[model samples]
Target: AQSVSQHNHHVILSEAASLELGCNYSYGGTVNLFWYVQYPGQHLQLLLKYFSGDPLVKGIKGFEAEFIKSKFSFNLRKPSVQWSDTAEYFCAVTAVSASKIIFGSGTRLSIRP
Candidate 1:
């Protein structure tokens, strides 16, 4: 069975601290991975995604993710933290042939200013 897994349920960070959110999948075949974020009062938006070509993809707000095929992991990274970056992050995966998308349990990030 293919599924997405998120290691952190809640995370707290101070301003200027580095952040890393772990995400892994169990699919044996090829898959498209994505990181989506929802701000406190805003709609969910894409942070980054990995489909093909580059293993590393950069997204808005200094966010980046590296896809490691061997580990079935696509971890999100941010060098610095801000209060505005506080949000819930979800990792998603979908197979190229499958229409359904599986989402991991979201991680809530809180930043102290």
Candidate 2:
């Protein structure tokens, strides 16, 4: 079984500020990591994902994440954030061949204009 952990529960940033959210997973074998964002009153949406090929994966809305196998981490990053970026971020992990996904508690991002 694989599990994910998000280091920060809440984050606050000003517009155009750089953002990074820590996400760590516990899985020895092949696994997939994903970052999902949920806006106010909206459903969860995929931000980025890491399955294979590249360790650094780019996603929608200028979001990206780097998968560091050695560190068991897949941290999300954005060079600049906007006020509209305010949302809840969730980190998830699953075995390559597994059907069940384990999600982190989630991190709430509050962006100031």
Candidate 3:
């Protein structure tokens, strides 16, 4: 079974500040990592994902995640954030052969102007 953990429950940052949300998964075999974001009243949107071919995957809205297999980590990063970027971010993981996805608790990002 695969599980995800998001170390930060809530993150408050000003506009243009760099952002990095820690995400770790417990899975030994081949797996896939994903980052999803949900705006205040919007549905969950796929931010980025990592399966193979590349350890570093770039996502929508200037977001990126690096899949460090050695550390079982897939942390999401944004060089600069904006007020509109405020949302709840979730880290998910699923085995290559599995259909069900396990999701983290979620980290709320509050961007202050």
Candidate 4:
């Protein structure tokens, strides 16, 4: 079984500040990593994904993540953040042969204006 761990449960930052969220997963075989975000009232949206090719993948809204297979980590980062960026972020993993996705505990990001 695969599981995700989000190191941070809550994060606070001022507008224009940088952000980084740590994520680690447990899986021995091939897997896919993802970052999803949910606004206050919006549905969960896919922020980024790593299927193949480059380990460093760029996502929407200036977000990027690096998939480190050796460390089993897929950390998310943003150079600068806005107040509107406040949301709950989740890191998920699904094995290549599995259909279910295991999600992290989730990190709540609060950006002050």
Best by lDDT: 4
Clashes of each: 0, 0, 0, 0
Give candidate 2's whole-model lDDT.
0.95
How high is the CA lDDT of each candidate model?
0.94, 0.95, 0.96, 0.97
The residue ranges of model 1 lying beyond 4 angstroms of the native Cα positions read none
Pull out the clashing pairs in model 1: none
- Sort the candidates on lDDT, descending order: 4, 3, 2, 1
Range of the 10 consecutive residues with the lowest summed lDDT in candidate 2: 1-10
TM-score, cand. 3: 0.98
Report the C-alpha lDDT of model 2 over 19-81, residue by residue, as the tens digit: 999999998899999999999999999998889999999999999999999999999999999
Q: How big is the RMSD of model 4? A: 0.6
In model 3, what lDDT does residue 74 have? 95
> What TM-score does structure 2 among the candidates reach?
0.98
TM-score of 4: 0.98
Q: Write the per-residue lDDT of candidate 3 for residues 21-52, one digit (tens) a residue.
A: 99999988999899999999999999999989
